[model samples]
Each structure stands twice: as C-alpha cells, then as structure tokens.
Target: MSLTRRKFLSWLGAATVSTTLGQAAQAASNKHFSGYPQSHGVLFDNTRCIGCRKCEEGCNQVNELPGPDRPFNDLAVLDKPRRTTAKAYTVVNRYENDGMLQGPVFRKIQCNHCLEPACASACFVRAFTKTATGAVIYDPSVCVGCRYCMIACPFEIPAYEYDQALVPRIMKCTLCYPRIVKGLLPGCVEACPTEALTFGRRRDLLRTARERISQFPERYIDHIYGENEMGGTSWLYLSGVPYREVGMREDLGITPAPQLTAGALSAVPMVVGLWPVLLTGVYAITQRKEKIVKAEQEQAVAAAREQARAEAQAQLAQALAKAAQEKEAAIAREVKKALEEAAKVPTEQAAAAPPADTAQTPTEEES
Candidate 1:
C-alpha cells in the first residue's frame, strides 16, 4: 500500500503524542531493566504438557473471550499448528519431537509479556502498559487501532478483532492481570493438572527453570527460553528438544524489543516537531502565489480601465477644442458682416445728402 504524506505525518504525530504522554515511563525503560521486583510470571515445562488444551479453555473462560468454533474438549484441533487468535488468547500446539520416545510434545502459545515489551514501545497511543505485576496489559479505550504492537512483538502474540468493524481491538493474553492482582492464580495455571504450567515471581520462576534443567540434563535442554530472550519475558520455557523443533524462533536475540526498535522510533519526535512548520511554510508559499496572481489580475484590470478612461478623456478634449474653434470662426464671421454694414451706411447717407443741398436753400428762404 502507498503511504500517503498525511497518513505518515499522522502516525508520526501520534508517536510523538505517545512519547509525550509516556515520557516518564519511556525514560525508565531506556536504562538496563532486570524485570520488576517481585513481579509474577509463568513457566511452562514442555516435557510435562499432555496437549490437553485445558490452559486454552481456562484462558478463554477467565478472559471471557468468544467461544471457539471447535470446543476446547476436542483434541482434533491439536492436529494443526495454530497461533493465538482474537477469540483465543492462548492455544496449545503439538510438535512431533523425534528426540523423544513419547512421540510428540505440546507447546502452549501466548503473550510472553516481555520485560521491555515492544508493544508498549511501538504503540503511538500508549495503549499497552508493562505493569509492575509483570503483565503487559492493554487499554482498548486509548487504542487508536494502529496495530504496531502486533508487528513489534517478538512472539507475534497480539491479535486483531476483525469481526468487530466499528471498534476492533488488539487482543492478547493479559497474564490474567486481574486475577494476579486479586491474589488468585491465573486460570490456566490453576487448570493444568499435570503441573505443566507454573506461576510465581519472575525471579523464582527462573530459579525453578534452572533447577529443572540441572536436575534432568538428559531429559531437557540446558537453556531456559525467555530467560534473556527479548530482554527476559514473564513467561519462560523449558523444552526437552530444541525450541525450533516446536515452531518457536530461537534467533530472537537477548536484546529488548524497545531497544531493537529505538533507532527508527527515535526519529518520530523530530518529525513531529518539524511537520507543522513545514506544512505552514508550504501554505504560506501557496497563499503568496495566489496573492501574486490575484494582484496581477487586479493590476491588469486597473490598467485596462485607466487606458479606457484616458481614451475617453482625450476624445472629450478633442471635441471641446473643435467646439471652441467653431465658436471663434462664427464670431469672426459676425465681425466681418458688421464692418461691411457700417461701411455701407456712409454711402447711403452720402446719397441722401445730395438732395439735402437742394432743400437747404429753400428752407433758408422760408425761415
């Protein structure tokens, strides 16, 4: 899928917000952590598990998860290898161990609840919490449904609720966090009749795993899985054969999940701080370009109007000049007519004066 810029920025922003929200917790996680003091954990002895799926039933019952398609009593489900699902927080898988004359070994799969949980580190909403009780619990209310926790998990324990489209949740084993808090054993540990699942303080669990391995060197492997894997998980394992024989990954090194992803996640804060400024600058530049275009349009219109006004003014000036010239020509013609009429009056009077000379001698005799 194509990662759009807006989506990328949103993820970065969420990461930053998560960091800010959990800054104190994150700061403490950066240091060398050796698990919380007196925190509880579970130890699964693979040699003892009978593939009963009792733990699976207990988990479903205790967590109130949805009923599986196949009932927990059905052993037929163990034939196929299965991972934890949204409906099932834990599942038991049967592995054919060629090293064991017993023919097959059972392995229980669930969230390890790592000491430094990658889920907590990867979450951009601070949805996952590594509580003091050794349970990495999740709060669905705060979850943005990013699902980064699913990817960051070394065991790939987190499951998505695909059925609930409106409000999907990332589901996983909480280690029976509520049960532990109330001084009760986890339902899975209580349900196991063969003593395959052991629950106690994390430190004590490690001691117990070591003792079992040392006591039965011939029957089990010396290495206790999760002792240091992903910087020590709350759930440790003791297997008769190699872990890889049971579909478990042995290559996930001792480094904590948070440290493994710190390099990439560290850049989130920088991006978060700079993204808004970058967007603002882009907006400003866009606005400036728009303003320039608008100004140019206005100037063009103003210039066109000015040119029209100038043309109209020049036309009016020419008309006024023509009218003045016509008025002056008419005045000059009237003056010339007046001068000709004035010159004609002297001639007419001279004609009348010839008769006056004859009448003047008669009037003098009459007087």
Candidate 2:
C-alpha cells in the first residue's frame, strides 16, 4: 500500500512512453511525395536579352497578373534589380558592367524549373508538379501551408501569398503551358522583337546555344548557366559576362536536390516505425533495473535499522545483568555485616553481668 520511490519513477517512465508514442504517431501520419517522371522543361537565353522589359509586359498581359505601381512600359524600374512576385511571374533586372559604357545588361528572372526540382521534391502534400512540358505547375487544393518547398527551392522562385487572408497559394511561372499545348509560342517569346527570349524544345535550345558559342566565341560565356547546375534546370541561361555578375548562384553543385535527402527521408519511416518497440523494450529494461536498485536500497536500510536495534538490545541486556549482579553482591555484604554486629552485642552483655553481681554484694555488706 505504500507509495514507494520506485513506483513513482515507474509512473514517470510510463508518462514518457505515452508522450513519445503520441509524437511518433503524429510523425507517421505526416505526408510525403516522390515526383512524376517524363516532365518537360524550358531554356532561357539571357545573352540575347536587351533589358527592354518587354517580357515583363508579355507576362502581365498573358497571365492577367495584377498591374504594378509603375506601368510595364515604364523603363525606370529596370534600373534596379527586381525579383518575381505573386502579381508578376517574371521580372527583368538590369546589371551594368563596372567601368564599361556598354548598355546595361538585362536578365529575366523566373522559376528555373529544375530537372530535379527541389520544390517538387520538398512538397509533402504534392501541391507542385514538374510536368512533361518542362513547366512546374502548382495546385492550391492540396497545399497545407507548410512552406517546405520555399526553403527547398535553390533559386527562391516560389513566392507565397502571405497577404491573402484565405486560400493563399504558391505562385511562379507556368511557362504558358496552355498556349504551348495549343502549339503556339509563349507570350514572352512572341512579344520579344529581338529574339531575346527563345522558346523551343530544351534539346534544340542546347544545340542553338552551342552553335552560338562556337560561332562567336568572344561574345558569350563558355558555360550554359542551368545545363548542369542543381542537376540541370529546364530554364537555362546564356550570359554575355559571367553568370555571377547577373546575380545567378554558381556554387550549387550538380547533384539533384532530392538525392541529397533520399538517404534520410528513406530512413525516417524505418526509424519511426521501430522507435516504439525499441523504446518500450528499453523502458522495460530500465524499469527492471530501477526495481532492482530500489530493492537493494530498501534491504540495506532494513539491515542497518535491524543491526542498530540488535546492538541497542544487547547493550540493554548487558546493563540489566550487570546491575542485578551488583545488587546481589551488595545484599550479601549487608547480611554479613548485620550478623557480625549481632554476635559482638551478645558478648558485651555477657561481660557486664559479673560486675553487676559484685556491685550488689558490696551494697548489702555496707548496710
């Protein structure tokens, strides 16, 4: 009936098991995805672009993207660098070469639509898809607002509609897929007068890029920007200067983003699935250990208490026996002294009787 320390520890251990089990159950219920195959893609040629802001106008008109504070025709915004937003699927930013009088270089910024797109790989709810047309499309219905894709995307292309109160979705360039399906050029490619933005099969674009590089070796950089970066993006780039000068990240290695997490993601289920049984076994072992320790502690305490009690009892017994022996010795000594005193008194009385007789005879003669 006693609430011992061991019982309290066992209850605490059970609580820990319940808490960990709940967490494991929640983890098991979470969603994940492996992407679809045979997805198509596009390639962008930046060297041919002339900083005209024409692609900006084309995207806005085609997608019916919201009108900006400054009209698309206003060329002043191109003076500074700009990123893609919900209202605009793409933007044209100007990067002027230092100490060069040449016209400011224009780069069109949009989703790169990676071959192993990180956004697609990171989406647990399967909201984003890399289609066979080389376009990365998004579905809002399945989005759970986790935003893992935003962190996974190396180019930071996907922008969330945080301002919307309800039904916010990730927005980016869809590569004008409806028009492409209809066997028509994308609006941006159609609108460009100087062939700044090229729209074609990704394979053909690579051939065109190589021919240009070989034709005019001094005009273009030797490397294509997205051909192999992050395991080959569909949206490739050809810059007149270095890609870094135009704000492109060159350091992201050629490995596919999904491959980076394949090992850990594959192991998560096994680890989570086995954790409960493993933890339960460990708990049982630890509980038994605690019980053994508690038994040993209690036995030690009881032994100590019993030893102390026995020592006290032995000391008491010895004291009582010594007292009884001393009392008997004292009683014997008193009895002996009383007998000696009694014997001496009788002798004194006997010695005094002849003196009394002599005294009585002298008194009669004198009378």
lDDT per model vs. reference: 0.88, 0.77
Model 1, range 1-367, lDDT digits (tens) per residue? 2368568767777878976564433433546889899899999999999999999988889999878898989999999999998998899999886675477999999999999898998888779899999999999999988888888887989999988878999999999999999999998999999999999999999999899888889888889999999889999999998999988899999988767656665666876888778986998899999999999999999999999999999999999999999889888888888988998899778868797776688889999
Estimate, for each residue in 1-367, the C-alpha lDDT of model 2 and write its tens digit: 2358457556666655653442212223344322234434455666667777788788888888778879878888987788888888888888888633366677888888776688987887778777877777888899987889989988888888989878888888888878887887777778887887777777777788888889988878899888788888777788788888889888999877877876665565565556656886898899999999999999999999999999999999999888898888888878888887888797778767676775688799989
**Candidate closest to the true structure, highest lDDT:** 1
Error of 1 at 319 (Å): 52
Q: What is the lDDT of residue 114 in candidate 2?
A: 79
After aligning candidate 2 to the native by TM-score, how far in Å is the CA of 181 from where it should be? 2.0
Off by over 4 Å in 2: 1-40, 99-101, 294-367
- Each model's TM-score, in the order given? 0.67, 0.69
Local error of candidate 1 at residue 142 (angstroms): 1.3
Error of 2 at 85 (Å): 0.8
Candidate 1 Cα deviation (angstroms), residue 190: 0.6
